[model samples]
Target chain A: MHIRVENLTHIYNQGTPLERTALHEVNLEIEAGERIGLVGPTGSGKSTLVQHLAGLLQPTTGRVLLAGTPIHSKGATARSLRLQVGLAFQYPEDQIFEQSVFREVAFGPRNLGLDETEVKARVHWALEMVGLDPARIGPRMPFTLSGGERRRVALASILAMRPRVLILDEPTAGQDPQGRRALWEKVGQWQQETGMTLIIVSHALEELARLVERVIALRAGRVVADGPTREVLSDARLLRDIGLDVPEPVALLQALRQAGKDVRTDRLLPAEAAAEIASAWGLRRAGA
Target chain B: MKAIPIGMYVPGDSILHRLDPRVKMGVTLVLMTIPFAIHSPWSYLTLSAFIATLVLLAGVPPRTLWRTLRTVFGIAFLMFFLYLFTTPGEPLLAVGPIALTWQGVLAAGGQIYRLCLLVITASLLTFTTSPMQLTHGLEAMLSPLERVRLPVRELAMVLTIALRFVPTLQEEIDKLAKAQRARGADFTGGPLRRARNLVPIFVPIFVSAFRRADELATAMDARGFRSTPHRTRMRRLHLGYRDLLAMLIVLGLVLTLIGLG
Candidate 1:
């Protein structure tokens, strides 16, 4: 579903001594089937903004429209909006409470009042999507799994809900390099297969550069940049000013261009940059 | 998620903030006795003036005091109303089914005054003292309990950890609630439905709390924390002239209130 936030503002602990304004008149439009990356430093209100997509947080002033429906309206129900938008929180493995992985993955389907057969099918399908063999992992206690395994189980739990819009906050955090790559690959495949709108919040610009077509940069609760991934990553000054490290390849491409080389700086990922460099230098690989 | 406000002792360089926590504890104890000694309105007024002067000298914001008062306002009102109606005395005023008496007013007013003084004094102590200082003071006060094998050190350690994790747990709960709400879990249904809805929230909260406790235990073990009887502190607390003067003033106040009563 298309999500639009207009002049959204959120003030926490209003009228208290610890009152804080987390989001300030933020405006953004997300189209359906679009892969968007939300990039920001800690405490930049990225989490606060994304929580509004699923109606988990009510806007203090403005409004959020999901599929042309204002989610904060009098008739709006967060429960119905939630079915259309799934949010997997940071370190979601900590939320696991069931005895086994199967039951844990089935929790969402059960909550949705699905039949037994359909719930089982969803659990199995979700586990397979995350590259975990249901037969091998289903009966295992969730608490006994390794960190990466638990993370995948957490993702599978949300996937069982089959939301049209998926929001993941740092889905690959605290994972080994191999695990991170595998998780992202699965996420990419899921998005493609289901054609769901995906929003991933992370500090890893390089990883986001590989998956999302567009990036939204936030600094102190306000949108600083919103555009194509390549365009956003190539803007070195803007990225550095917001405390985000531009992707290595993008930075290198910028440096090469500044040194009077005829190199394109818009390529963000390493593979894309390598291809551009080969064509620029007119070099032919042995395999090609 | 907002950090738990426990141990959120605001950092300040005021005289009250700098006072030794042990002295503060002693003075709080002494001040608590004045309410017991108060019989007439004059004694209560004297105690109220003393407390107000101390609060003013501490330089705490009036907003902070009101916030603390608001927390117990309901209970204070309930106690006052209960005593006003239930106490036996000569009737002073009658309104519909309710009858107010002279003795009832005195009793209710005294109870309310005592309740307010207790809450405000405790809040003042917490406002001026950091958790670390409070824990240190507790340990010192309970040191003699070590002879009875009460695990005083371990208890203090547990308290310190619990205080430290209050904000973390609150943040976790907030995050879990949002996460659940994002998955079609409604917590605003009818009474029965709402109670049922809490299943998802409480399950996650309990799971995370246990997980956090385990992680904290591991972290403490990794940091070489052990149950040792003799351990050195990074910061030691000492009582100075300010503590002595404060203690003497509190003692004098208590004595005068008792003598008048």
Candidate 2:
């Protein structure tokens, strides 16, 4: 699903002494089947913007156009909008509350008022999508699972909804290197199969560079930069200015440039960056 | 449950805010007894005037105070009808299946008035004091009971922590509800169904609360927190002359009401 946030502003606790503006006139459009990464520091309105996209929060001013229709508190659009967007929050514990993994993943499908056979089928399918075997993990309790396992189960619960726009907010949080890699790979595969519009919100640019093609960096509740992932993450000054840690490849390329070499910084992957430097050195030596 | 009006603290700089929270709590206890000693309309008026003056001295926004009092009025209104129908006394008239009596009418009005007064006194104490101040005040008041080998400090610590986590728990609950709602959980059903839906939220909350408590215990232990230690206070509670004068005036009023009754 395509999402258009036009002049969106969200002021928390409005008309009170403790009023605060969380999002300030944030305008963006996420095209269908687009893999976008939302990068920002804490309290920079990334969560607020995603919540607006997921229909969990209403805009204080302006409006959110999801699939070309305005969503009010009640009506046909708002009612059906909930299933169109799936948001897996930053904390796995926030979404994983069901006792059994089967019941947990089936929560969304059951809410759709599906028959038992369909609910079970979706639960099994979702579990497998997150790289968990349904036959073994279905009957077990989610709380009893390992940290990465619990995270995947929480994700599977949201994936069961089969949302057109899938949002994973720091889904690999607290995961080890191997676990994070596996989880992202599973997400990549699932998105490829379903062609869902993927928006991954993370502060880390390294993991995001591998996942999303487009990067939208938010600083102080405003979209500071929005472009291709390689183009956005390549600018070390932009990453540092936005208070985000520069990815390793971007940092390495910057160092190479500073060391008096003509290396391209727009390469996101470490291997691509190394190859770019080798090719640049080859061209330099050939000219010499 | 967005927020209970009674739990809300209205920030102000009036004498009530400056007064010791212990003294304010004591005044609440003293004011609660006035409802039991009512013998005539003069006493009610006196109590009302006295409560109103104290609220005025508190200097809290009247609109904020009214928001707190609204809940009390709702309870009192329901109690008025219950007392009118349930209490058996001198029959004054008949309303449908129930007989309206003179005693019942008097009882209903008096009880409603008394209920409203007690709530006002209690809410006044909370309105002017923050949770931290309230907890410290409670601890100071309960300190004397340590002579009986009571874990007063631990009890106070528990109270303080519970008060502190109320907002945290509320935030967690809001997040959990949002997460579930995003996945198509319906909370707008009947009360029973709403409650059933809330189970998913509460189970996670209880689990997280326990984990947080465990982590908090470790942090406190690392910081040399002892249950029965000599702890120094950063903001000590001192009773000023104003506190003494307030106590004297409240005592005098209670005594006067007693004598009149």
Candidate 3:
């Protein structure tokens, strides 16, 4: 489903002394099959804004429409919206509680009142999608697993619901380099195969550059920038203003460009920069 | 739910804050016992005066006292009403279906006074002494019971962990509630329905709490927290001249109250 947010605003503890405005009048749209990256510093309201996409939070002032229907409209049930938008919370491992991994992953589907056979199939498929062998890992204690393994299992628990729009909040947080790369590849492939709308929130600019086609930058509960990945990320001044560090390669390319080198600062990822540099040198060699 | 800050000790350089927690604990124990011995109006007045003096010395604001008193106000009110009706003596006044007597007034006053003093003293200890120091004092006080394998250290450790995580779990609950509400879960239903609605929340909370407990256990194990008979203290409790003087003053007050009774 295409997620539509219109002038969304949310304030926590509305009348109390600790009241905080977590989201401003934000407007954005996620087209079907588009991979969107959400980048912001801590307390920038990226999480609050995305939580609205799944109808997990009601906008205090505006509205969120999923598939052109107002999710906060009267009679709209969270259970139905939850099925359409799967949210993998930060530190999702804390949400795992069942005796075994199988039961934990099966929780969402079961809550939806799916048939036993269907629940089992989704559980098996989700475990496999995250690259965990269901037979080997299904019965193991989730609490005893390694951190990376537990994170994948947590993601599997959400994936089992087969949400059309997958929202992962820092999916690669606390993972080693290898684990981070592997999980991104798996998620990217899954999005491509299923054409699911993917929204990933992360502080790691380099990691987000690898998976998303578009980037939405948030600062102080407002959207500072929302556009194509190359366009948003190439604006180093804006990124820095919002407290986000540019990806190393992007920063390096921008520096080289400032030094009058023929380098494309638009290339945000390391691989993209490397490929562009090699092609440029290849052209020079041909001319020579 | 923001952390309620119960049992939180704000570290300061004030005299009460600087006192050894063992000394505070001992004084608190003595004060708690004196209330039980109060049987007359004069003795209750003496106990109230002692509490008021301590409250002033501790420098706790009136707001803190009110917040602590609010928790036990219902019980205090109940005891007041019970004693007013039940105590027998020469009638002082009578209203429709209610008789007021000197004995009844004294009984009600005494009960209310005792309840107020108990709560105030407990609050003073908790407010002035950090949970870490309180737990240490408890471990020291219960050291003799260790011979009977009572697990004093383990119990203290558990208390410390619980105190540390109350704020964490409260923050988690707030986050989860916001998350669920964003998903359209209704929490504003009527009492019974609202109670039932807490299942989804309670499930996640209990899950997370257990997860935290497991992580804490692993961290503690990695730090070599084993059941050992010997451990050195970073700050040992010693009875300084000031503590001795404070203890003697408390003992004298207790004696005076008993003599008045």
lDDT of 2 by residue, B1-261 (tens): 243445477777888888998998888888997789678887888889999998888876676777777877778888999998888987889878789988888899989878878877888888889888999999999989999989889888899899899888888888888888888888887899999988878888888988999999999989988877678889999999999999999988887777766
**What stretches of model 2 exceed 4 Å from their correct place?**
A255-260, A283-288, B1-5, B39-42, B85-107, B222-224, B251-261
For candidate 1, what is the lDDT? 0.85
The true-versus-predicted C-alpha distance at residue B86 of model 1, in Å, is 3.4
Worst 10 residues of 3 chain A by lDDT: A279-288
lDDT of 1 at B98: 81
Error of 1 at B119 (Å): 1.3
TM-score of chain A of each: 0.95, 0.94, 0.94
DockQ of each: 0.48, 0.59, 0.15
lDDT (0 to 1) per candidate: 0.85, 0.85, 0.82
Question: Candidate 1 regions off by >4 Å?
Answer: A13-20, A74-78, A115-118, A134-136, B1-8, B91-101, B147-150, B189-199, B202-215, B218-229
For model 3 the TM-score comes to: 0.72
Rank all candidate structures by their DockQ, best first, as comma-separated numbers. 2, 1, 3
User: Which tens-of-lDDT digit does each residue in A1-288 have in candidate 3?
Assistant: 877888889998675445799999999888998999998889999888877887766678999888888876666363576567878788777665567899888877786678999999999999999999999999998877998999998888888888899999998888899998999899998898788999999887777777898999999999999999889988889989998777788888877788888877888877778776776666433333
lDDT of 3: 0.82
For candidate 2, the lDDT comes to 0.85
What is the fnat value (0 to 1) for candidate 3? 0.12
Poorest 10 consecutive residues by lDDT, candidate 1 chain A: A73-82
Q: What is the lDDT of residue A84 in candidate 2?
A: 82
TM-score, every prediction: 0.90, 0.91, 0.72
